[model samples]
Target: MTLDFSVVTGAWQSLLLGTVGTLFLAFSGMALAMIIGVLGVVILRMQLRLPSLLVNAFIEIVRNTPFLVQIFFLFFALPLAGIRLNPTLTAILALGVNGGAYAIEIIRGGVESVPKGQTEAGLALGLHKHEVFRLIVLKPALRAIYPSLSSQFILLTLTTAICTSISAYELTSVGQRIEAETFRSFEVYFTLTGIYLVISLVTMWLLAAIGRRAFSYPQR
Candidate 1:
């Protein structure tokens, strides 16, 4: 069969909007994940028995479960408790929770890698406990884990395509609609693969730039 990419030409606007939607979901989710990751680490470090255990439990539960099942549970189950989030919100929340679980472990490893002497030095300098963590530990720990964290974020970006399964307005959902209308599955999916590659590459470039700027320091 002859390939005809022209079938998707008429849907360019829809595709563009979908791309924007995907980016929005990915970045927003990423922000939430970072918040959760950092806070989880702090809670774990606090060494409080109950809170630490709860944080560990959350991390374990999320990491052990399938993301699709988690998303479905949020979308379909929460309403039973009178907490109904729309599809877009559900997708973002699901992505954040899933990504956060992994982020906690990744970040915790970095935090643990930090020298205990650094924390003690910060305290000797009369810094508050929170300030010490922030100034002495958090920055270096983040730098150590930035590569792994960025990779996870890139994966999170691709995972946005799965949000289409929940009727979220993203590139994959738009492509599926176009494919249904034009009956050109190969061409549609082929274009989508190309677009996703472009997105991932662009994301990598941005992450690299951010890392350089944020973590720039004289090398030992």
Candidate 2:
């Protein structure tokens, strides 16, 4: 038997909107994760036991728990505590918090990769500790770990589909609605699978380009 993809043309608009929503969710999440990762690394590098323990706890909690549950907690459970977040904001927070936990570890590895000599040199050269870490260590470390960070970001993008479970109205949700209206389950999901693939490919490409530009250095 042949497939009937005639429904796609009709569902096109919704799919496009859903795609935008998905991209917004993924990008916002990754950006917030980057902030958290950078700050977390700095805190960890300070070697302050209490702060490090707290950061570690945050990472372990997010990493060990289910992401879907995290999103639900933000969207549904928070209201019980007299704090309410809109679906989009909750989705971003969930994705960001989850991705950030992993990002912290990955970035900490990067920071540790820097030679101890460099840190010593910066300190001897009259730089403040924070300045030394930021200028002499963090940048090069980030460059070294760019590939791992990019991969993590891609994984974070794929996780955007989970946002649909909380009614964040991303691509997966759109596909589900389309399937209900058109009664074409296979077609809906098959198309969504392809769409996700394309989305990931484009995201990877963009990340690569940004990495090259942001991390590139002049030849010695």
Which of the numbered candidates is closest to the native, going by highest TM-score? Answer: 1
Q: Which residue segments of model 1 deviate by more than 4 Å?
A: 218-220
Best by lDDT: 1
Q: Model 1, residue 199: what's the lDDT? A: 97
lDDT of each: 0.94, 0.90
- Each candidate's TM vs. the true structure? 0.97, 0.95
Candidate 2 structure lDDT: 0.90
Candidate 1 displacement at residue 189 in angstroms: 0.6
Q: Which ranges in model 2 have alpha carbons more than 4 Å from their true place? A: none
- TM-score: model 1 vs. ground truth: 0.97
Cα lDDT over the full model 1 = 0.94
